[model samples]
Target: MAVEGGMKCVKFLVFFFNFIFWVCGVALIAIGIYVQVALGKALVVSGGSSAGTPVAILVLGVIIFFISFFGCCGAWKESYCMVTTFAVLLSIIFLVEIAAAIAGYVFKDKVRSVLKEGLQEAMNKYEEDPTLTEALDELQRKFKCCGANNYTDWANIKQFQANDTVPRSCCRINTTTCNVHPSPETVYEEGCQESIEAWMKKNILIVAAVALGIAFFEILGIIFACCLMRGIRSGYEVM
Candidate 1:
């Protein structure tokens, strides 16, 4: 009777964990979409290779969303075959998440150079491309930064070389004189690259926390699923 009771508890625990996984899937999807949009905007001014991460996250979330349903049905029906399949799929996802975490860590170091190159390219073509001009202006305004390295960096822009003027977005105070006659007191001294890097570090920590928390729950779900799979196979009458 005690063993039967334990199996019954495992059955419900698997169901409960599957529900949690479903909720997590929804959360991941929401986060993925938010990050994807944010990155899309930023990449307009500072193109980089990190665009794949959010898309991968979105795809993984969709997969998890569907797989959780499968797991829920397996648990409720006490089907050994279905439960085993769920366990296998969950394990694969767990491995993929770990690999993604490692890849993110590796890519973190290259962001600075990527941002510098992209910003420089955007600046050189700022006058030629209205889209780049608008995006770069928004980036500068948002970051409260002037140029790739500093305000002086804008002096090298081909279109601005004649007048030696920077964009109004580089002004610390948006006065007419600030752009026409930029000086240390009138323009932002800080570089966009530094400001953007700081912003990314701050947000990456939040992403890391969410990823770790989800990973913990995923581990729990896998363990419970395995337990339930064994119970079902052993003819413990989990139903």
Candidate 2:
């Protein structure tokens, strides 16, 4: 009777944790989509060099979504094979995420240079590529800044040179009829590169925190799953 009661308790806990894990998988997918849609535009404008990050995130989210479904089913059914598979999948995910987190941290310093190069490339093509133009415009306007370095950087662009005007997105006010030659007081003197880099740094920290938290919980889930499996095996042995 005691053994049965203990097994029941283990089963319930395993099921509950697996359920939560499944929910997390769903959340990952949602977050991946959101990040891709939000940041993918800018990355795309950068000649697709940085596009892999978001795509990888989306792919990982999908894998987690499916693997977590297996985990939930395994826990609910108390199936040894399913539970074993879930354990392996979770372990793999944990390792992959840890590696990704490490790589992101290690390469954090290089992000600015890469972004600067990509943004410059996009800026040069801004007039030719409507999509790129819109993306750059949105970035500039939202960040309340201009050019990769400063408004003067726009002076070199052939299109801007021909028109003898910088993008209105550089203006502090409504851009349509804003100053063609902006003074320090009339427009943002700072460059978008600095603001964008700061914003990216803030987001990176946020992502790291969330990823670490998920990994910590994943460790617990793995323990619960293994314990439930052991309890099943022991119960069978006793029977």
Candidate 3:
């Protein structure tokens, strides 16, 4: 009877821990979502030309929190499947963050190179014929994707405060070395606009899937916590 009583006490403690974890998971999810799309909240600082916040980081943070919650529940209930699912989800979030950072670095270098080439080609085109102004405009549009603002673009301090929604790709970098124009202008380079638009569209689906996965785990955790608590209570009897 003593041994049986000890097991019941242990079960209660485990279930309580799992309940705490569930609360933490819910809190993390709430914070992440708020940071991502806090429409009503005032943005303390603007990220200039960026989609602004590190949305992927926010998403990954939420996922990790929920995974922990699920793990706690799984521990309480002794559900191996729930535990395994949490592990897998956590792994995916980590791997994706690493991959995305690497990709962003590599792609920034590529954008700079393409922009340099386009600038050179445009100068040549303009010099060929003063009357070839039409060609100059077309080439400007062509190089929009490979705009020079690859790395520092998002960190732009000055905003293109405009009524029209100008895509970030068109923003020109006002570097100290620039002799052409002292005041920077948002010049849409050839391909930058289209590329960002395409990337954003693709990114949406990826983000949605991750959010759903987190939600799923949170629900599972709640269910598991309830079951384990019930089991713990039932396990104890005066007999």
Q: Name the regions of candidate 2 deviating beyond 4 angstroms.
A: 162-164, 175-179, 235-239
**Which one is best on lDDT?**
1
Model 3 over residues 64-174: C-alpha lDDT tens digits?
A: 556666666665565646645654554565466557657766786654454344433433343354433343334333344322233223223223122222223233654
Better of 1 and 3 by TM-score: 1
Better of 1 and 3 by lDDT: 1
lDDT of residue 80 for candidate 2: 83
Candidate no. 1 TM-score:
0.91
Candidate number of the best TM-score: 1
lDDT of each: 0.83, 0.76, 0.45
What tens digits encode model 2's per-residue C-alpha lDDT throughout 99-143? 877887798777777888878987899779898889888878777
Clashes of 3: 13
